[model samples]
Target chain A: MKTKSTIAIIGSTGNMGSAIAKSLAKGSNRLLLFGREDTKLQTLKNDIHTLNSGADVEAIGCPKDASWEADIVILAVPYAAEAAVAEEIRPYVTQKIVISIANPMNETFDGMVTPADSSAAQELQKLLPDAQVVKAFNTTYAANFAEPVIAGVPADAYVAGDDEKAVQTVTELVQSMGLNPVVAGGLAVSHTLEHMQLLLIQLTVKNNYNWHAGWKILHN
Target chain B: MFSELEKNLRQHITLTTDEFDRVKRYFVPKKLRRKQFMLEASDVCTRMAFVSKGALFSYSTSEKGSINVVQFAFESWWMADLYSFFTEEPSKLYIEALEDSELLLLKADRLQPLLADVPAMETYLRILYQNAYVALQRRLEETIGLTAEQRYLRFMERDGRLLLRVPQHMIASYLGVTPETLSRIRKQVS
Candidate 1:
């Protein structure tokens, strides 16, 4: 049985956010799209409704002075904007599973990027200490998100958080997208996965390879 | 510095006094003289060593053979080329002692059982990796977005303690800047 999860994508107009909204619309009915730009939010809402007629979707502009009442909140904003978003929505996030999809890439086009002591996810976690911040979906490219499979590999998304229940919920969400969800274990493990993404990005650019390559956990 | 590392390790990984003792049995305490190579490039990183005292650095040589310092592991920190250690592949990295050092070394075969016996070690490891990943992401972002001077300022703001211990040349290497560039940035910032 597919459990209906009330979801809100904080930055729905961006490439990854829109892709997530599309994927969720196909699988689940209840979705609320939020974006700073009103036109983008309305456009995404219309697109999701058009694609999945049965999907119960709503679009809202500005999370500030807005009710963030949802089971899950997907933070799809840039890494630089994450702290502000977390602060704005902190009071509204009562008991929601917060998933950060932003990777701390350089704001400029200069090579690899991330902070020295912590990741964007960790920074978000610090800001919203109450919300269960699970790091996932940051590794995969937006172009690969719409596809059923990435390359020959079934896009294995890594989910990591301190809360077991939150992890399970996000795992199910990943599975719903027709992608495998491997629990990489806790928020700290996010570091390894993020570094792996850096490596993947380097490989992709240096080798002139497709962005389809993703990680899969092999079991004996 | 070692105490901070111990506390960080203990917070994430739980070890029974007995398990800690058992794990301690496998670790051969050894000293690394300054400039000593702990692990070399083209070698499989077979050991995960915990620093009980002093500083060490792990770095890789670029195409031009210029050494790029990736990390500096101070006292109580775990140091290794994780990719090489896990995959048993020849490392592009070289690990060396930055100062006179004492480390508790554990071989891979021994580490597996130790982690299995002490599940908290897994938690500790997860935290360690998470912290590393977070730092890497931030560094990458800084590298890309921030000006060279901004990056140096941010680095100092975050790791002021490390600035005192690690030399100017190594700091420059870690920042992906030349020593002269770092000196110039420092002068301008100061």
Candidate 2:
């Protein structure tokens, strides 16, 4: 039996956010789509509901309201908006399973903008200090989020968080999207995932692996 | 001495008493005096060491023959020239103890069999490598992007314990700055 989780996707109008929303719509989860623009939120809500008629979905103009009702909240915004969005929902983010999928990539996408000591997820955690920030899906491209699988194999999404329950919840969410969730060491492991994104980006641009490429842990 | 290694491994995967007993059998216990080399440059790094007590560091020499610190391993930490250990190539790094240290060395030959014998060992090794890899990646970024003062401050913030234990010059080497520069940075920050 699938657990019906109430998930809020902040910045649902964006590519990564919309892709996650589209994937989650297949499940019996209640989706709270939050965006700056009400019309885009409404369109996304309608599109998601159109795909899964049973999905109880809502369009939220206020980001704070989205965090209030969601069991799991995904900050799907760009790196630039991470701090601002986190600040908006800080009051309502207490103990919320917050998933950060943003990579602090520079404008050129060739290098990272985040400082070496801190990761974007860690920065988000610092802003919403009470929220359980789990880093996931940062390694996979936004293009891959629509399906989250490649070449008949599920893409491995590394998840890192300090809280055990939050990590497990995010892991379940990743699995719900038909992707493999790997419990990467801890919240500090977000440092590695962010760097891994840069390496993947470099490889993709240089080798032309495109959106079809996804990482998998081949263990014996 | 084995307690730290056991506790660290148990955090990730639980092992039965008997399994742990067998696991300990594979590691060759070693003791190194302060400044003694566990591994030297140009040798094939056939083994990896787990520090049970005290501290050690691995470093490489520059073209001018000046040493650059690469990594440090204190209690419960693992160290090796991974490329040389895995590929049977000559090591570019030299690993030496900063203080008299106890270590549990695992040779390359025994590693695979140990993993097969105790599946939890593989999980433990995987977690260890993952941590090491992440730390290295972060350090690389810090070296490339951050200022010396920023790097020192960040290191202090993250690992204050290391700040107290590791020598100033070694920490300077890790941060890619001279000892005098690190001193100035420390003073400025303080």
Candidate 3:
């Protein structure tokens, strides 16, 4: 972009978060990895540096450190922990483009646990009113994030956010990972993205398909 | 019947008159009076209903006889015990008309051929489910996460038309609140 964007990832120790971190490391961007576990964060940072030696990645122990100056922040925490995490990151959230990849799937994975009338991103946006919350990457599996390509075809990233600039920022980030970005519409559509993830999970379980299968929007 | 469905389909995908005519025959039109049950528990839900006019809803009752409204389908919306329709199992949900409603019914037997003959309809159906899946999940999350007051306010903000049409008790059930609680919330909001 205009300059090497500083990308802060909350919950970077998780599989989804780490996968996103690994994929985005290819570009000339600095990564601030936020996590509760110090050793896990250190391990992830080392792994990223090993994959791309020139990658500037640092492990941040505190959530507030992420707010210092990140151009965009990705929330990769569990759906249940979203409010707590949002509160922790609140002070630094002003004007920052926040990307949510959390799906409010129930513990049984049979269905979702969120209120049927709202979505995870909507809840997060309400909690962090100052931040621009965009929903992306929740529909695509973490396995696909490693390369964003399967069978020589690039995976698609459906992004939804109220702010056009924020959506554009995340679209570029999705592009950097070698994925195609489709602006799915305003932030309210995040509900659709989250539910789409649940449907994918159900389909995979029913068909005995592995987590690697991804969806592509085919148009004429 | 085809005109309303065509209008809804056009919002997602444009279909030529020839393709539309080919696929339209698969749907059978049906009507239900207000409070009539279209689908009952313990019966196989062999068909999915698309609301052409008026409203209907599906609900499941707890062992204690308390009901939780799972879905409400208005004009241009689809309703069925999807699991039962797909798997041919007995449905645990009850779908009843809330108003004198007309629906375009598509049986499971006809769905495959309809898709096979007009393959583009598959894409349209996918887009339809994409939107429905999202709406259902959002409603589920809101039902779980928000308070009765918050949920009622959100419903009022998003789908206030339902408030004018649906019975107060049914709306309360949908919000997972008791009728009295809904009344209190309404009073508080006003």
Candidate 4:
């Protein structure tokens, strides 16, 4: 029943970030878009407004400023850059939802970069004890974000977070993007979720699945 | 769009051009895509919006998620859940755009400052509220007293222009009748 949450998407000019922004525009939430280039973010903002003119969106150049004003913060940077961005906005994100959407793939894209025991999301959670770090969108490719339906079923957006309310908030958010949200249990489940992405990426690259593959759970 | 607002303003109170110039800053401009929700039942109505373009409708829902259509607003009309706005409670109604809409939004917190800054705005708001009250009473009377056929006839007479903009299903909801019943009534009238 929640409506109109303020969400900040850092690195919003990236593939995952822009795709999420465009689809999320259809919802009533307010979006604070931040990226390396202000002009690019503004262009992305305009595109979203084109899709839904009633969307409340602003392009912010400062990451800290955008994160400071938002209720939920989605870190869409690569795994390599996540630590720096997390620390930069650490102080401002206390009690706020910080979603990690990076799949820590190795340079060759054949394997993951994170330790076997941890994930990008878990590392983010460790960095910001005050913020609710949830892992989502890591399991799906950027292409699937625009059109969530693949194989005639809505792709499952697997979300993992320790905070139930934050998890629920993200579930609502994923639903807003016209996807199905599967609560994949506590943040520890993020390691598996990240691995799932790694496997999918490898499969797509190796077998030429065209990067349109995503997860879906079917039940009677 | 500003002309619609200006014409609406010119009817009630006199405002110097400079005064009207200052009035525009208090309101933020927003656009809603067709079928976009302006306010959902779970949201405490934080903004009262004036429709500058397009059309919108508001409705309340039962626990089972069936809607009871309440009102529709077109260009130059204002829409808000007054009870939610005043009491700061979660709204019981959902306000949605029937078409791509441009709205000038007045935030709840800005109301006092706006009235204080522009004394003429108070006169305009008073007239707006009075007319809104009169309209509400008339709507209630029609809802309770009129037969379904009479209501359909009255709607065709008064809001026939909306037929092109609003869907027949929503219009049926607004008339407090089933879609089949409305379809039968439409056939009877034709």
Each candidate: what lDDT?
Answer: 0.76, 0.82, 0.83, 0.85
Task: Mark the regions of model 2 whose C-alpha exceeds 4 Å error after superposition.
Answer: A1-3, B1-190
List pairs with backbone clashes in candidate 4: A53-B31, A54-B31, A54-B32
Candidate 4 iRMSD, 1 decimal? 9.4
- Cα lDDT tens digits, model 3, A1-220, are 2224568898998989989998888888878899888888888888898989999788876766674446578998898888988897775665567898989999888777878888999999999886789999987888888857767888678999998878987898888788889999998898888888888898988997678767788889
Per-prediction share of native contacts kept? 0.00, 0.00, 0.00, 0.14
Give a tens-digit lDDT track for model 2, residues B40-143. Answer: 78888877888889888999999998889998888988999898888898898999889888777786867887999899888888888898789989999998
Q: Is candidate 3 or candidate 4 better by TM-score?
A: 4
Off by over 4 Å in 4: A1-3, B1-190
TM-score per prediction, in order, is 0.51, 0.52, 0.53, 0.56
Scanning candidate 4 chain A in windows of ten residues, the lowest lDDT window is A1-10
- Per-residue C-alpha lDDT of model 1 across residues B1-190, encoded as one tens digit per residue: 2344446556766666676555444454444557866687887887777887888998888789788988888877788888888899888888888998776666665677768777667777778778777877887898899988888888888877866998889899988889999999989988
- Candidate 2 accuracy as lDDT: 0.82
Off by over 4 Å in 3: B1-190
Q: After superposition, how far is residue A86 of candidate 3 from its true place, in Å?
A: 0.7
- Worst-scoring 10-residue span by lDDT in model 2 chain A: A1-10
Would you list the clashing residue pairs of candidate 2? Answer: none
What C-alpha lDDT does candidate 3 achieve relative to the native structure? 0.83
lDDT for each residue of candidate 4 in A22-99, tens digit (9 for 90 to 100): 888888888889988767887898899899989989887688878765768999988899889988987667567899
